[model samples]
Target: MRSNCLPFRADSAAATAEFVRPQRYALRASHSIARCSGLIAAVMLAGCMSAPPSIDAPTTRASTAAIDLPLADPSAGVDMSLPAQRPESLPSNSALARDFMELSFSLESGRAIPQFSRFEGPITVSLGAGAPASAPRELARLVSRLRGEAGVPISVGASAQNHIQIDFVPRKQMSREVPNAACFVVPNVSGWDDYRAARRTARGDWTQVKQRVSATVFIPAEATPQEVRDCLHEETSQALGPLNDLYRLPNSVWNDDNFHTVLTRYDMIQLRATYAAELHSGMSAPEVQAKLPAVFARLNPAGGAVRGLRDDPTPRAYVSAVNRAIGPGNTGARRAAAMSAINLAAAQGWNDTRAAFGWFALGRLSVQNDPETALNAFAKAGNIYRATPGAGIQSAHVDMQLAAFALSAGRAQDAIALVNRAMTPALSGENAALMATLYFIRAEAYDTLGNPAQAQQARVDSAQWARYGFGSDAAVRARAAEVAALARAGRG
Candidate 1:
């Protein structure tokens, strides 16, 4: 996530401290690959059978700114027809059917996910070592919401019998807790479904017999508060069941491209349907189909009129561009794609939020090669972000980005100003790692200005924030120690 060099003392104290850049990884699924068409048919067939069926399975592969410009309406170019009061009311029978099928099947190679099946028993979740301090409370809130809204029997507690393990860890340490494949292998990923192993029954149905369902979710230590929340919601929900991701689903987090970070009402409906008494883990498509009408009637009774809707292609395109830009290898092509997306979004007059994201991606891609261009892009992003409602946290992120760029450009005073502005109190889960980096930059700025005392204090502050934000991982602690030693030498 962070890539830069830091100044350090040449003394023995400094020699003991090692500085490591914070790097982010992507999430990848391990297993066989299956064609999407076959997967869909398999899902349908699975639900159709009344008797227990045996089957062989195949695998398938899968911004900031505050400006005075006219604020583009957040709802503009967006489908706001989905009722806020009742998310369940928005999905038509067709939508529900499609969503249920997708959720019931695992996308990580067409394997059948052994779901909680029934909410009759307790589902305990425990936080692992180095988890964020806020993890327990935030998880509790999510569990409570799910229990109340989806009738899921889940609670937050540790037991040998615990079915879930949630961990908030530094990126470098992710491989130790989750499978290496589950490690953030993709670029621009904040979290991952690190470990999810389940055993199925002899009937090819996922049953309680010899059943073992354990999941581990990895959250990068550098993630901001909002990212933390989204990760908690999405990863935890996926761990429950519905391990597949469908890009076609516009209203569900199940679609990575949709950008619906939090669990939507539609997501809740799907979960409720999965855990519904009549639906079992091993049901074939026809079997599941037989129970669908009743399920929809009970969930949405009066809202069965199907309205075929699709997510806007602009955002999806923009997301693909950003992903390409940050993707591993192929740096030149990635940057070119990012630039092209930014230009396209600008030319097309995409919605403020979407366009702003494109600009932000461009800024990130161009920061090293073209600081001025990066600054301009970030500033435009900030302007658009300020205009969009409910984007205060995002605005903070932009400020941080600007600060990082300024620091790199040797504009110490400007960097300090931006860092100070970005640090204003806001959300609780703001990325501590980013905050620590900001403080580190501020310290460097003070050092450049020959303000030794202030620089030392800023360095101390940076170390403190890094410890709190990144946990006590060996690398993190080493970095903190290096900062302290650097500050001490600067005073000398």
Candidate 2:
């Protein structure tokens, strides 16, 4: 989710948790508002790097000096990780076209974007005051991807006019102004003060901008390195490309139904198309829509294969229901909201990821209060995820939830099997938190089965990645204790 001037991002397997941010939004690292021992908090919006301001970017290297950085570099010690890139299943041009229109024409608020917007020349990025040690390394890596994958002419910070400034404001201050925003990007603002004054006025609105002159992305200064990095991927992507996030999108960070923490292949294609020569700033919605067929035909020729499902538009009621279910509210209300979202998805005849997400949300919200209902919801979500393409990670998330219940019920073998099924996809997704939780669960299951050696190994692996996922030695230990307690409470 992004917030400075937009709505907060929602999550899936990772819509993965909480729904939109209030006012301008912040993208949470995971979707689940609450992650206990087993729930893998599904958010962690799409993911980073540094390069010169150029249309041409590297094939592998993210920064020119990335490899040359001294051993003393601070990021050398940061335990952050990125998943390996996997090939994408292409959406037909027809599907791509509809997504493009929706993404370009309106915001999550349903407010219209009067015209298209993009920087007309090379864009430079700079880290502003109070940015943490982790930012530069992450920014460089992202810049590399933007240039190489998205084909955007972006570079490291410069004093020049074409620029995007990223400021890491303390979370408290951000929460006051942005409210619920985890982080966000805004057009025409250069710093926090600029955001403060312009935020309530038209100056900060994305829809008002025709050609993006300069923008600023506001992030939480005190957030963990991983959290900060997650914000960078989401807010920065919006600063460069589309402003709206669609729930119907199965892939791409552009959709809040789910997330890709690091920009997915789908996101790269969209960005590449955004910067393609055929389009430009100030084009009308219809104009951009008209040109996208040729754009997709050339840029994503694979999508030309066949027509796609091209699902119907998601209703405002459904979106609102999911948001309430995942967001702050009383337990009864949250449950009611979850139920409403489920009914709405069914009524819409959604047999897709969107529906699976609603079920996932119900399972998550019910885990604490309605055990039987939670299990059944998880089962339903798991079934749909299994049948869906590119939803292995989502299935893994459902497995994570079910393994917890199984462990609590003394089903050690069941817990172990579910953990095993989820582990690979968790690793492939580079979701350290989910991976950490899974390892912890595995360790507990091994111990229940009287496998001390395996349990010890799992604990060791859990600690290793927990540092990356949970951040800091103390945080890792705390998370371990939480999971350890869950196991202790289980009937082994």
Candidate 3:
């Protein structure tokens, strides 16, 4: 989920308290909230599950850099041990059993969500086929005792039959146009034969064998897609493995296993800043924003208390200090700040609004001679806005950046599409100015596309918008010159 600002509501001053910064709004690295800087590169969002920024075409490089660093040793492999015990224990009290007894698993078809189950529980007892006759009673009693210790009312439930159902639902960050591949079953993993059969019986047709489920998570503003997936895989597996290690967990619940396995593969992924640090042995300003989505995906931290991991406050403090240092500087401090925000998102629990703010802020740092970074940041912002709800204004701003970024990236078709999306007749004042910029971008995109006729028309449209939008002689004259150039080119 792209975290961006919610509309300021008259009814919820208290609710919006956490986001009350000195500035009414702050642009992080995202287009949804920042001014377009033509030269800055994009960075990833700093949240869990976010995609990395995609880079424009890389500039041609010589065969070797002036100096190269030594390579690190290969990573040691993970211990793929299967646990002997199940994560969820059975309830002990028969009385408590009824409370959780109704628990069952269901899978969504044609979506990444392999399955999810909710049951009433101080403890819920789900018996495997091998469960002994006394399993339910023992489970209920065990749960009641646990609840009593915690000073909570005891409720428990159990099911004796080994029944499992698979369901599929939408994945997060799913494109509105096309549905990504979903897992009804994965390539290898077991025990849900009955579940698959049941579906065929119910639907009266054979379906795909399996679906591999991915955690539909929001990416931070400064990571990449690969990085986001890796981070999510690690956190999810680490969080859930005590009860269900992928190695030993029954095939009935294999979606969760596959999900975790996928994430483990991404644990080493890094954002541009971090990648640069690793590669250069020093921090450097990111050269582009398009590299963020993948990195952010891998390192986004889950907020709240995780069940088993030891807490580390160092990363938390480091990111915070970095943000403070960047609040005013125009140099390395700003770069550090942007990197810190991404790290913070990975350490802290940031919602869409916070993520959007961070991304917008990051974008601002790229405004100078780094328009590539700015364009990338703007694209990231637009993507965030698309994920965030109740952020029309922010989304509109993001569209403006997307248009500009596309132009800068040499993606003329995309630029025109972004311009079209950003233009809304109802917008006024500052928004109108943005719309005019969209026209300028579209004209630029069309020119790049070698569509001289459309480019000329778009230039005329841009000139009209420039007069209305900027109200500056320089703007009019610059656009007029562009229009004249288009005319001359057509004459030739």
Model 2 agreement with the true structure over 256-276: per-residue lDDT tens digits = 654355677777888888899
Worst 10 residues of 1 by lDDT: 3-12
TM-score of 2: 0.83
Ranking by TM-score: 2, 1, 3
The lDDT leader among the candidates is 2
Query: Model 2 residue 489 lDDT?
Result: 45
Model 3 regions lying over 4 Å from their true place: 1-328, 367-379, 425-430, 476-492
Q: Against the correct fold, how does model 1 do in TM-score?
A: 0.49
Q: Estimate each model's TM-score.
A: 0.49, 0.83, 0.32
lDDT of 2: 0.66
Summarize candidate 1's per-residue lDDT along 1-492 as a digit string, tens digits: 111100110000111112111110001100111112222122111110111122223231100000111222211111113223322235477667656765664443345544333223567777767665556666777898788877777888855553666666664555354322222111111234312222132422333222334555666664433345556777778666565665335355554332345576677877787677777655665677678777777877775643432223334465466556544446468668768777777777764565666666666555445544555676777777666644444455666665444443344565567666655411222344545555665666677677877766765555434443333333343333333232222232
Clashes of each: 29, 45, 116
